[model samples]
Target: MAGRGEKTVRAVRRPEVRLPQLAAYDGGELEAEGDYDGLEFADADWAGQSARGARFMDCAVRRCALDETVLGRARFIDSVLSGVRGVGTDLSQASLRDVEVSDARLGGTQLHGAVLERVVVRGGKIDFPNLRQAKLRDVAFEGCVLVEADFAGAVLERVTFDDCTLTRVDFSEARMTDVDLRGAAALDIARGIDRLSGAVISPAQLLDLAPVFAAQIGVRVE
Candidate 1:
């Protein structure tokens, strides 16, 4: 729909995580800087454990409990994490590439300064996720519910939110490129309405956000 050489935005590249036949992780506790590859972690209760700088490649983490677990600077590549429930899980500065996280139940999860590429998060509820200063590329969030999510000072490229519900989300000073919000089922911005320069939204969504937009520019809509 360009009359005079307007730019056409490209969509995000979804993650294709094909996990290999994995061995079961029957270890006692996750050690720091541990290298885990081609393993499966199911129904694990690793609350209050520290696994800083751990690497998981071609693994499956299913239905695990990560309450208050510290996984700072962890790296996950070509992995799938499904039905994982947790609270206060710390994954600060972690890296995830070609990963899929589905049906997760998390609260107060800290993902600040994380790096994500070709990651898909589907059918999950995350509350109060701290994603400040994160770098996300080609990330898609589908059929998810996010409450009080923070993206302050983050960089997002080719990120799409499809059929997602966002409540009280903050995007303060965030930078975006080719970010699509057209398929969001609900959108509620608690802060930083002025930081949506590179995002695309539907006409109906724009109308719904008119009041917030007006307030951002001090427009008296009387």
Candidate 2:
């Protein structure tokens, strides 16, 4: 049985963002390095844009097109990205707090060395996302498709993947504690099965993953 893990993800606090709308958007393009606060950037087209060190507080970016955009060192607090399309976007070294990304498509996005706290990714297709060396605390991915996503060397605490598709996902050298994968669709098809030492899964999942685990230990089941 996958016993209770040593370190579950700590409870994340809500983002302290109380931004009053100061001005309205003039429909002009945003500067990449600007600090936007309390803005409602709904349905904005940010495709292929570069926003380095941008701080978004109490922002609502709904139905925005962030395809191939670069958002390195960005900070998102109390932001909700609903129906946003960010295919192949680069979000390296970003910090997310109390961010809810729902129904978004962030396929092939790069999140290397990013920090996520109390982030909820719901009903999204985030396949092939690069989360190498990232730190995730109290993060949950619900009803998402995470096929072929890479989490190598990442530190995950109290992370939960609920009702998601996790085929071919790589977690090599990752430090996981209290990571609940029992609600995943398929865990046998994932790579690096032996590296998930401290993760918690259901009893039925262990039976399904037995063949993969046996192969990792060079045991040929005849």
Candidate 3:
């Protein structure tokens, strides 16, 4: 659990099989071996429903709304989404294992090519979340806010952004290995930052992003 550039964390990749417990559901299409365990979707709405390839285990969605829900390739395990709002939600290529999105409110959420293993976005409020080409493994964004989220060409493994609230979040052409933005709340107000090669910030978040790493290599930090 060292600081900057520390690698060697790539776990969460569960769900090899097991998932056979059906019953309880008030929404629409969620076929493909449907098995929503311990179901209890409260305040359900499921607008524009279409949960493709469904298979949610230990489900428990409260204050559910799922606005414009499509959930392509759905397959959440040990789920638990509270205060779910999901505006313009698509969840493209979804898989989210061990999910636990609390106080959710995903705005313009699409999650392009999603997979997010061992997810845990607490007190969420994700805005403009695209997560292009997503695959984020062992994810964990506690007390989230993630505004302008994109994660272009994403693949970030062992992700972890604790004190979240990354303003202009957007990792252009991302591929960060053991990504861990040191409990970010201001990684220089997050943007592209040269794609944050193999991210793992710490050490005071690299001295508070050192003026955005000297204006992206131009090095004129006067």
Pairing residues by index, what is the TM-score of model 3?
0.34
CA RMSD of each candidate after superposition: 1.8, 2.7, 12.5
In order, what lDDT does every prediction score? 0.93, 0.81, 0.75
Work out the TM-score per prediction: 0.96, 0.89, 0.34
Q: Candidate 3 residues 22-137, lDDT tens each?
A: 34566665555466777767787888777677777777778888888887778888777788886898878888887777778879888889888877777768788888988988
Q: Please, what are the lDDT tens digits per residue for candidate 1 over residues 108-213?
A: 9999999999999999899999999999999999999999999999999999899999999999999988888888999999898888888877789989999999
Candidate number achieving the greatest TM-score relative to the actual structure: 1
Candidate 3, residue 135: Cα displacement in angstroms equals: 17
The reply for model 3, stretches above 4 Å from the true place, is 1-7, 13-17, 24-57, 60-65, 68-77, 80-97, 100-117, 120-137, 140-147, 150-157, 160-177, 180-212, 216-218
Ranking by TM-score: 1, 2, 3
lDDT of 2 by residue, 85-151 (tens): 9788889999998888889887788899999998988897887889999999888888988879889
Question: What is the TM-score of candidate 1?
Answer: 0.96
Tell me the number of clashing residue pairs for each predicted model.
0, 2, 0
Instruction: State the displacement of the C-alpha of residue 28, model 1, in Å, after optimal TM-score superposition.
Output: 1.4
Name the top lDDT candidate: 1
